[model samples]
Target: MTTRRRAAPDATRRSEESRRAILAAAFDLVGQVGYARLSIEGIAARAGVGKQTIYRWWPSKGAVLFDAFLMLSEGETGRPALPDTGDLEADLKAVLRSTVAELNDPRYDEPMRALNTEILHDPALAAAYAERLDGPLKEAKKERLRSAQRAGELRADLDLDVAVEMVWGPLLNRWLQRSGPLTPHYADSIVETALNGLRRPTRRRRDQH
Candidate 1:
């Protein structure tokens, strides 16, 4: 009896298709029915797969939406990314500008708000979302700050984690609290405030003279 080799490429292609379908279904359903009402069964039915198929890859509806949240947050490029120009201020400004745009976009804003609300009561879900979605860009920003410190552009004594938060926190506060509109001016001002505090001290004019 001859043994037949299984086709690895076919299996891989099918897996990609199924994953894409599942993500698409979750994204559409969340927008259509809101996050609280979305379910694995509903996603499975919409994706034309068994509920078991979803369970094979993810543990729960929250898990599925964690992946879906990543997709929604990626915008038209289908990737959530930050720029790295040699100038730290310019790079940070570009990213914050992108963020302001994302927050205001109807496609991302509504579903992201829904997801944020859902994660509050579920710590595990919140951690998963943070690890997958929030952590990378944050680490990248911190790394950029550290690079500036190395270049004598910023204070070496500053705690980078706190610095990163200083940049993110105000923007997030304004975004979530709805205290004010998220505009380019606000983003630029926030960046200026954070960066100014981090900049290296200059020699006093009197001392120089």
Candidate 2:
């Protein structure tokens, strides 16, 4: 029953070139001067667009930076889908390993760190970031977990919402905290630990009994 809002056909849309320029400008400026010093004026100047043009598409500097972050993430993450091999452990590990690779990319590291700082400081911006950037990825993970639940591979009573967070939380923590290398070894360990906690307890065989 939920209705999704669709853009009006007559809506004034920025040209693809302009949009690309703006995102590129944001990325370059953030890398040069850092996110705290980034502004709509600077981006406009770099992109050769009027301030109104940037404002028309995004409400604030934070929003613009968030969009730029998403643009870069799309390029690095490439469609944000998890593997569904029917083996939940394997699928989870595979997806998390890919995530570790993205986090380790030098191009993304500084820009994402800047964006994360902004989100952490602003509650409203953080909510918007989660909805726009993280929501789709989390929903995909939830869907895959739900499939496993239906197959009796996961506990029926498990809260898939928390389960999704568990799958991602540690990886993000390590990436953000700089506590350890975000390698496949670390990713596999996180998956095994989380899945072991979530998996349904196997019933004993008749011969064992």
Candidate 3:
């Protein structure tokens, strides 16, 4: 009697092939036709797989697009993320710098831009966008904030929810609005203003110069 691996080399290769084809087709069709016209059927046809194969893995085009965008970014917004070296500002600057680099990648920008446009016009798609895109980024930002709080680098009284937004809100506003290209210096400014706040400090009698 002998035991054979259920996932044989051929089976594994086939699975990889299907996955690659699905992703490639999803990206290509979305890039070619735009999200409004993209269809599972078109994707399946382009991928050379049955529609059932796509459905078996992802429930909707939004899911596929979300994953494809993430793949394109190589998890820039979430996975393989922020380093905690006890310097809150340094860690955030590093993260934001990576973000700038990711947004500049050609593979990442178009599909994400398409998804963003769709999210604005459709409620269901908007919800999926939140779940897949915004939600993960929010969590990652929050975790970094918590580390900063723990280190006493950021104000302890800082509201975690608001603090997270404070750290990211301005940068995202610019990115989403296409207001301007973000620089590391811009991210650093956001961090400073968020942590130190907008008010100018009052003079202390002991510190007169």
Candidate 2 on 125-206: residue-level lDDT in tens? 7897788688878888888999999988999998888998898998888889999888999999999989776555566444
Higher TM-score: candidate 2 or 3? 2
Superposed on all Cα atoms, the candidates' RMSDs to the truth, in angstroms, are 5.9, 5.6, 5.9
Q: What is the lDDT of candidate 1?
A: 0.80
lDDT of candidate 1 over 24-125, digit per residue (tens): 898778778877788899999999999998988887777777787676556446444456566888888888898899899876776777778778889987
- Poorest stretch of ten by lDDT in candidate 3: 72-81
Error of 1 at 84 (Å): 2.9
Query: What's model 3's TM-score?
Result: 0.72
RMSD of 2: 5.6
What would you estimate as the lDDT of candidate 2?
0.82
Per residue, candidate 3 scores C-alpha lDDT tens digits across 57-169 of 88788778766766655636436446788888777777877777766666656677777776787898778667766777677777888887787777778778888778777
Off by over 4 Å in 2: 1-14, 50-52, 55-59, 70-80, 198-209
Model 1 residue 180 CA deviation (Å) reads: 1.4
Off by over 4 Å in 1: 1-9, 70-81, 197-209
Model 2, 135: alpha-carbon shift in Å?
Answer: 1.5
Quick one: best TM-score, which candidate? 1
TM-score of each: 0.77, 0.77, 0.72
